[model samples]
Target: MNRRNFIQLLGVGAGATILSSTLIGCGGEPHVELFGWSGPAATLKDIRLKVLSYAILAPNPHNKQPWIVKLVGPSSFALYVDPNRLLPATDPYYRQVHIGQGTFLEIASIAASALGYKANIHYFPEGQYGNKALANKPVALLELTEAPNVKPDPLFDHLLNRHSNKRSYDRTSLSPNEEQLLQTFHQKTSDAELVFKSSAQDQTQLTGFLTEAMAIETGNKARDEETIAMFRVNQAEVEKYRDGFGVAQAGMSGVKKIVAETFFLSREKLEKNPAGFGEQAVDITHAAAESTATFAWLTTKSNQRIDQIKIGRDYCRINLQTTAMGLAQHPMSQILQEYDDMLPLQKSFKEGYGIVPNDTVQMLFRLGRAKPTTHSPRRTLDSIISV
Candidate 1:
């Protein structure tokens, strides 16, 4: 089915049946309120803030917007992580958090280049991370220097257009040229490699793995509760928090949306029906994975903080490229998550991907043609900027 028909079906349960009520809805404000901040930033006299505004649009885990920026000078800012935003249950070691910071930095650099400035980034100016969790160390110090000759990033134009598409994707495969384009796009700072798999066998295997991972996560009370806490059930809660996962992000409408918000998205209801909810979660994830036309991952030789951040930057670039190619991408790295319960899945994932024991798979995602999706709500810049 075409994008329009698919979207209409989503609202009416015509094509794909009601997988999960939480996964159906167009619940919040429509005009991209948080994204609107970019307009003023682009025209603002303060170049640093202008670029930083675009950086805020970068994709982060759960839209946490973990970045904390302090305007230290006319053209520079100090980047820090908000301790409260850490995903202790899913990402106990802050690996994903650091990767998220890297994604922000990459977007900031691209935005700066688009505005005719060269961004100079210094990572971990204070010190490096210890073995387990991230310490009080700052993520980066960004300084922009005016360079009129600097060309804009090709992917920069798609920054606003890019979004994480969570809908069930079309089964049509990407063209050879498109596949080659994704494989060729490279980031120089880090030694991470982008790997793509589009075979039917690979897709089927991945679907099973992802489905199992979802079951594992939803079965565990603590981990499941962490996710449940982040579910913004209605438009009011979505706008209020503007950070957590919500039904509003799903882009549904009409009766289906109303039903989803009232029933499936309710935290209390989910808690009462843990088994049913877990089954729905697995079903939804399985369907999404089965719909994939391609699967891509980023692997690095090391799992150091710098490596984690580097992979995040690469992941951001990949998202932009996918957007430019008129394709949708969704990260499904639950199996690669660094938690005790996830250890076995992680080992299997590494081995399946042919990654060396010393190497780490930093990111994994499904890619395919998909209908247009609504952008997730974001916290305003004021909320994230340090005083």
Candidate 2:
């Protein structure tokens, strides 16, 4: 990628090439074929549906698009967490689930902007739910009003292009100018603290922390099965479910993905006996950490329902911003999760890194240059919308 595209990807200026659904926003990469990557179809005449078509592309934990919409009026809707679709094992407090909700909202708002509509959002319309649990209350109520004077969001150019890259990086570090631009962009977007580390000592400590965190996270029966249940074993399943992830989302492609699926990967067998699946998760997590040269994180003063959702929005925007910079971004947040068995390690990590005991490290991710992976699939928008 050129330096011009690199700076644009980091949101330094306004020039960006709008992409069609077939393009993965990687500048010169091959054309992609995922329906979810496509923009609002020509057939989507309704304004609300058009915006929602893009909202479904929002990234979420483990590709579980945990969102439910109740159409409230001709131009508004209520958003809720799909109680049935959550990562209770890894996200024991539904923090990541709420973050997913924020990502969906951010995408919808950006889509609305590109089409001359202002998305008016009201959070927790009924009442605030508990910080650590799910409730029936709607997450937000969105009202769209046409705004002829509104400028299209530049981030919209990257809607279909943005993705969570999950492959080996090229081992390049961000220049001082690039890092400063990112820090400034993040500070302007949210109040959360943005921390970037790229030293050799930092990499050694973090890769170890991340590798051990994955081991602890996947060392349980329920947790391993939760991930396996969502694993699409092959393309047949990828097209069949139109959701979850497989080798494609993990940076495997063509013959490698095919061979792995045919010979080694079996969803049914893994689901029944998931011990082996955890081993792969550990290996992949450690390798991903070692492959990258830079790491960043977001932390907040407290952990509440609203805080999680707000940070989710912040995290999603940072992901998009990185995409614009002609760089690859991936979240390696296994060590940031809140679970009993993982607390000791989490505490050690925070203290070692100078994060205060009371503060919550909401997001932890690796960043570098790498080839983009296939977009994670999404079920039909109708599946998420309950009339």
TM-score for every candidate vs. truth?
0.88, 0.91
Off by over 4 Å in 2: 1-31, 35-38
Question: Residue 273, candidate 1: how far off, in angstroms?
Answer: 4.1
Model 2 lDDT per residue over 1-387, tens place: 332332222222112222344444322233344545445667779899888888898889888889999999789999999999988898998888899999999989888988899999999999888988799999999999999988877888777768888777767777778889889998887999999999988888999999999999889998888888889998788888877887666577665566667776777778876877777777777677887889999999988888888888888888888888988898887888888999999999999999999999988999998767777788888899997
Q: Residue 12: error of model 1 in Å?
A: 7.6
For residues 171-237, write the lDDT of model 1, one tens digit per residue: 7667778878777766444457877888888888888889988887777777777776676777777
Candidate 2 accuracy as lDDT? 0.81
Off by over 4 Å in 1: 1-38, 41-43, 187-190, 271-275
Which candidate comes out best when scored by lDDT?
2
Clashing residue pairs, backbone N/CA/C < 3 A, model 1 = 25-252
Best by TM-score: 2
For model 1 the local lDDT of residue 265 reads 60
